[model samples]
Target chain A: MNAIIEVQDVSKSYGGVVANKRVSMTVQAGGITGLIGPNGSGKTTLFNSIVGYHPIDSGSIKFEGREISKMPVQSIARLGLIRTFQQTRIYAAMDCTQNMLISLPHRKMKFLDAFSKHGESDHAKAERLLEFVGLYEKRFLNAGSLSFGQQKLLEFAMALMNEPTGLLLDEPTAGINPTLINGLIDRLKRANREFGITLFIIEHNMRVIMNMADKIYCLAHGEMLAQGTPQEIQNDQRVVDAYLGTH
Target chain B: MNTKNIIFYVALLVLTAIAPFLFPDFRTQLATLWLMIVVAMTWDMTGGQMGYNSLGNILFYGTGMYVAAVISIGMVHDVGAYTDAGRLELMTFTERQYFVGAIVGIIGAGLFCSVTAIVVGYVTFGLRGPYFAIGTLGVAIAAGELVSNWGWIGGGQGISLPVYPGNFDVGKLFFYYLFAGTGVVLFMFLKWLYSTRFGAAINAIRDDEEKAEAMGIHTMRYKLTTWAMAAFFVGIVGGISGFQLIHFEPLETAYQTTNLGIFMVVCVLLGGKGTLWGPVIGAILFHFIKEVTWNYFLGWQWVALGALIVVTVVYFQDGVMGWLAHRKPQSPRL
Candidate 1:
């Protein structure tokens, strides 16, 4: 598979706490790659470093064969590498459609467009994305009113609206309802399959990660522990000992 | 536009059009009303929309005031002599000179403030939340002091503007209408802006700035744009007020940080910060309350202000607009 994102020996730390120690990983184009680790294994830190939320201390990251380790979040996002937060951060005061509208990162942001109604295509696309997330009826309602599960779905829809080439989602199913988890998994798969987008997901849920990802990498104590296909990682003795936290 | 909005705006236009003739006595008050609205609206741009509460907008106002006074007085009269004979108030200008000078001053003030906004925005927008507010407040005080010590613009004593060339009431009406026209334009423009991607982008910054940046918005650009827009309107309004007042005092009248500075912020909050109509309603209500209390209570006006602010802030914290937006009308059947 052609690699879309390449991280080579990246190291990041916060004042005596090494979060990601010489961590290197690759995400292939049009594929769902998963990162799983035990608590405080630097999973979120690695996600932040990859998506340019913060700078790494050492090493390089490449997006679609272009260097992006030094780029800011918005710059990376403009290049179609978007990431969603672990806690959903929808523009709460705005309605779902407005939230979707703002998520669009197209370059044509004229001031006069504020007065004009959203273009038919923009509205149609926003509506279609909302429906994809099962939020069609709540399109007009304020995002703050949505439940935690629903907010995550809105966030997912928001990311999709950007039409990104690569998406880095941090903990997409954490704190979501068990029932909604399946729906999220299906949407994630469809986004990858139908949209032809690459996904690098950091998940704590083993079942979801095992079910969705084509390949899995595990981290422990701020270091890579193992990487393999679902069945291989599930059966690996070290993975079971460190990450599963049980015999 | 929808029929409801169109009808509402037309009705508003009608009320404003007939206002000066209907109450000729209140033309001066009406002019003040328009100026107050501009202040509230500009303040709202920073305080409500961009989530950057600025205490130093008065710096632009004060600068524009002095700039207009200097330009108007310098025209058709010697600048040095005018400052020297300030106690006599003897300088004068031809009608054409005054109009030309005032027009130039107004446009110049807006341009000057917007340029200043770029410099100040770069410095202040870097600071977040309360630090930004305090930094701007410091800059504003320093600006007032700088002008206070500057001899060219008439140091501590202050400069005098030329007397109106024609009838006093007509002059008052002229300013009243000038202010009214710009107020309407500013209001409608903001109303227009509040609907666009520009509006959404700024609102996104206010809601979650980090997330807004991650969403591919250059947050600083929008923040600075909002600040510059506020500066443009406030600057013009200040220049107009300088001409209308016929006097320019440095600390008291021009900068007056303790008085008019705080009043603008209070007015925006009193109406609603982010919403378009909030500033208009807030300014109107605040001006009337101030006029009534100052007219009747004399030295006790502060007492009235304190009491009213407590009631409004405690009970109507969302301001009048937020309160109005929240209330649903009763069904006719019910």
Candidate 2:
């Protein structure tokens, strides 16, 4: 598999505490890639580094053959490298549609022309995507009113609205109910299969990542413990000892 | 605009047009009302839309006042002589000079204030929450002190504006129309602005800056742009109000923090911040209460104003617009 995202020897630290220690990984161009680690193992930090949420201490992060470590979050996002937060960072005050509309990476931004209405296509697309998230009936409801699980779905839908080249999802089902988790897993697979979009996911749940990832990278104590197919990673003694204990 | 909204706006315009003629005795008061509207509406851009509740908006208003005064003075006579006399009668002007000077002064002051906001924004927008609010407030107070000490623009003695060569009533009428027309134009523009993509983006910034940045909305550019727009309008209104005052003591009328600056912020809050009509409605109501308190309570008016602000804040925290937005789902107007 050709690497679409190359993180070669990247090391990030906070003060004297290293969060990512000379980490190296490659994501395939159009396949589901998983990063799983124990708590404080810097899974989220790695995701943040990739998406330009903050500057890394050292090393290079490239997206589709272009360096993106120094780029601003918005500019990085404009290039279709987008991410969703582990905690779900949606606009709760706005309706699902408005939240969807504002998430577009290519929305027109002319100061003078802001007075013009949003495009009908944007509204139609927002509706269609909300429907995709099983939120068609609640499109106009204030997103704050949505349940935690529904909010996650809304965030997923929001990310899709941007037509991202690669999507980095941080714990997409951390707090979701078991039934909804199954639905989300189905959608994630469909998103990868039908849309043909590259996905890099960080997750803690063994059952979920085991079922989904083409290849899994396990990080332990800010260091790469192992990398292989799900079955191999599951069998790999270091990864099992580090994280997948008894699972 | 839709036909219903069009008709509604036209009727509102006609009512405003007939306002002065209907209440000729209250023309000056009506003119002041319009100025208050401009002040509150401009303040809402930062305080309401962007959620950067700045106390230093008075900085732009006061600076615009002085900028317009100086430019108008320079137009009629040399700057030194105009400020040295500190008398409106001493500085005589032609009709051409008066109109030309006032127009240039208003527009020039607006440009200057916009630049000031952009410059100040780079430093101040980096700050968040109360740090930003207090930072702006400190700047405004410092600016007032700076202007008072500076000798060029009349120092603490203050300056007088150009005497209108036109009839006294026409002069009043002219400034009246100017402020009233400005009020109408500003209301419509803000109404349109808050409905657009730019408006949504700025509101998004107010809601969540980090999330907005993650969405690829450059929060800084939008914040600076909105602040500059707010400053430009305040600048124009400040410039025009200076000319209206004829003569103003620097600290009191032109840059009075308590009377004008804080009051503008309070007006936006009272009306219902973060909505299209909140500032407009808030300004009119605020102006009315202020006038009544000043007339009846006299020396205790400020006491009344403080109490009223408290009542508004404690009871109507979401603002009148926020309160009404919950009840009904109409756009723009009441």
Q: Which CAPRI tier for candidate 1?
A: medium
Q: Score residue A190 of candidate 1 by CA lDDT.
A: 99
Candidate 1 lDDT over A144-207, as tens digits, reads 9999889989998999998889998989998899988999999999999999889999998989
- Which whole-number lDDT from 0 to 100 does residue A44 have in model 1? 91
lDDT score of residue A222 within candidate 2:
83
Q: For residues B158-270, what per-residue lDDT tens digits would candidate 1 score against the true structure?
A: 77787777999899988998788879999988877877778888889999998888877768878888899899988898899888988777899888887788888878889
Candidate 2 per-residue C-alpha lDDT over B213-320 given as tens digits, one digit per residue, 9 for 90 to 100 = 777777888889999988998889889888888887668877788788888887888888887788888989999999999999999998999999898878877777
lDDT of 1: 0.87
After superposition on all CA atoms, how large is the RMSD of candidate 2? 2.4
In candidate 2, residue A48 scores what lDDT? 91
iRMS per model, in Å, is: 2.1, 1.8
